[model samples]
Target: MKRILRLLYYMRRYWWQALASVFLMAAVGLLDAFRVLLVQPIFDHVLHPGSPSQIISLYKIPGTHYQFTLQQFVPHFIHNVWAVVAFTLVVSTLLKSVCDYAGTYLVNYAGFGMITDLRDDLYEAVLRRSLSFFQKHATGTLLSTLINDIERVQYAMSSVLSEFLQQFFTLIFTIGVVVHFGGKLSWALLIFVPVVIGSIRRIGRDVRQTTRRGQDRLAEIQNILHETITGNRIVKAFNMEFWELLRFRDAAKRLFKANLRSVRAQAISSPLMDSIGAIAIALLLLVGRGQIQRGAMTEGAFFGFIVALFKLYDPVRRFATFYNNFQQALGASSTIFTFMDDQDDLVEKHRAFTLKGFQKSIRIEDVGFAYRDDEGEKNVLHNINLEIRCGEVVALVGPSGAGKSTLVNLIPRFFDVTSGRILIDGHDLRDVSTRSLRDQIGKVTQETILFNDTVRNNIAYGQPDVPIQRVQDAARAALAHDFIMRLPEGYDTLIGEKGFRLSGGERQRLAIARALVKDAPILILDEATSALDTESESLVQAALSNLMAGRTVVVIAHRLSTVRRATRIAVMEQGHITAIGSHEELMQQSPIYQKLYQLQFMDVQELPEPVMMGKSGL
Candidate 1:
């Protein structure tokens, strides 16, 4: 009920439409009741006017508490009895049709409008969540909630609102007619009301529980589909197609079983209610027959009462079905609300200042970090300090899991340090807005991330409206202009997913071109040339050199040859910087550095002169 109320709150903006729908639906109900009431007059007057007294009595409104005849209300000009009945029936039917159509339209308009707002807000909320939030939740589960779960809520809103409102009013009006005509017979039927209510409540509870489990199983199927499709390449490479198929089959089977349970629960409501209604109707018939024969009730009135009683039960049955559907919708809404209510722990402070630009250096003081998992918090980095000066190329070299990439990640505040603070130009990084802080830093990782877009768009990704001439200049600087021009469509060619159409070197060059376009003061290159072939590596290395010129650069490289030209080098081991000095100084003084240099540069004659003889390469 709370979830339903929350959904209605979204409809506040469309209150006028909702009110119009309700008004029209109420009119529809009133017309339905009037049509049933016409049964008495049709039998008493038109079909068999057994006596003059019967004719006079037929003129009376059948179901009204007061015995006011239609003759009293009709104008004298409208005199023919058959013409009056014909005209009234035809007009009532036509008016009911119009009101039903208009009512349905208005309700659907408001319901769909509410769904549109919900989907948009859900998307925005997901986008605003912190990176860690995405890490914690599965993409497939989130996708299911955003699309499938919300779709269920949409179905409930449209079907439930229209049917519930219309049927509720119809039930009320018909019950009034039945009570007025049948009196004692209607009161006898009330004895079974509590029984019907109890049955509906129990069935609805079972349906809600089953539906929730069904939805969860459906989400698992969706997750499996998402994983298999996205990881198709990995599956093919490892020849695990049959294994993936088996996994999908398992998920589908589970979902089928879950849905079957919900289906059984939903199917039980109709027949169960019908049987209960049958017993009540049989009792009503048995009692009403005696009243009709004993002169307590007229034959026409007894027949009309039966019609009204049946009409009343129709809405009751529909409401029972609606209750089950509402429970299903509530189950879906709970998952969606859970996601919406989650707060990002790393939200920026309201008044944080924007960092304008980089000036002197980036100082990492006493920084420690840990990643939280199911087991416990595992510390990755201990107290570490390093200073990177402007216009200097400093390379970070270490073995795998040596915290080289983690240290560079800290500069951009991707994950805040668990302990100490980092400062940029004497200002604490925490005091600055993330956007402003990241605006001055450019990164090019080994994996070359590119969107499935045109070559021109990919190059000018960050600054989408950048001039063509500027984009061409950046491409030329990164040595990507020639290959781009040689392509069939030149700059406008659509790159396939992740720029898969391009070679490793071409893709890396485009990444460099994107960084060049950003033209930030600080740059971080994480193994940028590590994955390319010899010729590709040379082209990519040259592009990297052009991108690094006069910028405050942090390079994390496993290839010692690549970092040989750095103004200084920091050697990290475990979670600490073991040494920081010129490449030669570290080679002579630090055994770790010497071991790495000797392993990679074993042939001294092939070593770059600057590294062998301690000369400045930059």
Candidate 2:
């Protein structure tokens, strides 16, 4: 409830629209009630002037001498009555058209405006969430919230305004008509109201529960759909099309069953209420007949009583329908509110600490961390101590699972370290605003995730407002400028999704170009050139050398050549640095480094001994 209230708070500025909708709905409902009340005037003033046979013609058809019957009376009459009926019909038709148009305009117009804003706000919330937040909720589930959940609440909003306002007004207006017709008979319904309302409340509760289950099922379907689309390659590679289809079918079936149950209950409610209302109508008719027999009220009065009875129940039926909608609305709104109610993962300090310029260095003192899982056990990176001074270049090298990426990730506080403090230029990284801290570093990783945008857009992404000449220079250093110029659209050529259209080398170079453009002081290169072929690697290596000339660079290298260029190589094993020295020093002192060097070093220039007289070194 609080969640929805906050959503409503955003809509406060649109109150004029909501106010107008309510006004239109109330006006329309009362006008409908007035139309129903017109029956009394027709019965008394037009139809029952005297005996039925005493009715006279109001117009003349000279050619055929045709006469309109009672069914087509008033406007069709062959007398003065024709003129009055025609005028009355024209006026009533106009009011009905105007009221219907205004009601439609206000209700739908406002519902769309409110929910569209709601979707944007919901998306904004998602974007503001941390990367870990995305890991916890799949694209499908989040997408379901954006689409299905919001749509469900939209109907709830429309129903709330339309049904609640219209029915309440109609009920009041009908009560007046009923009491005017016959207060005693209308009072009889007072006793019956409690039973009907009690039954409605019971049914409404079940409808809400079922509606919630239906939405949950929809989320599953959404999640499965997202998985299949994104993992379509894997599905095809594994020949699991049938399995994927089955998974989606299962999710769809669950949603179908849930919706069928909910809608069945909702469908039965109205007809059941209508049947009961018919019995009540029959009771009113009988009571009215008795009054007519006793000469207490005339036949016209009895007729009017029944007419008023129908009018009262019309609003009652609508109110019951509104209750059904309210139940489903509550079910949908609960999820939306829950999403809106979440506290942001990163809590910002009330006052941000501002730093003037970079001076000293980055320090990781006795730093340790673990990937915290749901089960509360921390995986270990212990007794870690490392430092990177200004203008220094260090390389981190180890086997596959050595936590090279994770260690660097902590520098930017992408994930806060589990049990250590990282200081940047003498200030704790946490104390510095994440934005300000990140602004001081640049990164280029192996898997270059590029958007489907122009080459200019991708290169200048890190610094969008950078001048064109600077962007061009960075591209030239990346060796991407010549190729980009050769493309059909030059720098404006659109890269396909994830840069799929570009060769592996081209994509890697683009990423380097982006990093170079930012020109941040502290740079982390995570196997940045791993995917490039020998030719591309050679070209990128030159570009990278230029890019790393003066920056405080930390390179996480797997290949031997990349590491040899680092000023200092930190040999990491099991998440801790085992040896820290230049390539020559490490090759002499580090045993692990010697083992790796021996394993890859060129064997004897020409077979050390004479190969068994023949076969040589075949």
Model 1 C-alpha lDDT per residue in residues 122-215, reported as the tens digit of each score? 8888887866778888878898899888998898888678988889889888987888788767888778889888988998888889988988
- Model 1 score (lDDT): 0.85
Q: lDDT tens digits, residues 482-570, model 2?
A: 88888889888998888888888888889989998988888888875345667987887887887888899888876667778788888
Worst 10 contiguous positions by lDDT, candidate 1: 51-60
Please give each candidate's TM-score: 0.89, 0.85
Clashing pairs in 2: 57-78, 57-79, 58-78, 58-79, 58-80, 59-78, 59-79
Worst 10 residues of 2 by lDDT: 51-60
Give the Cα error of residue 616 in candidate 1, in Å.
50
lDDT against the true structure, per candidate, is 0.85, 0.76
Q: Go through the candidates in order and give the C-alpha RMSD of each one to the true structure.
A: 5.9, 8.0
In terms of lDDT, model 2 sits at: 0.76
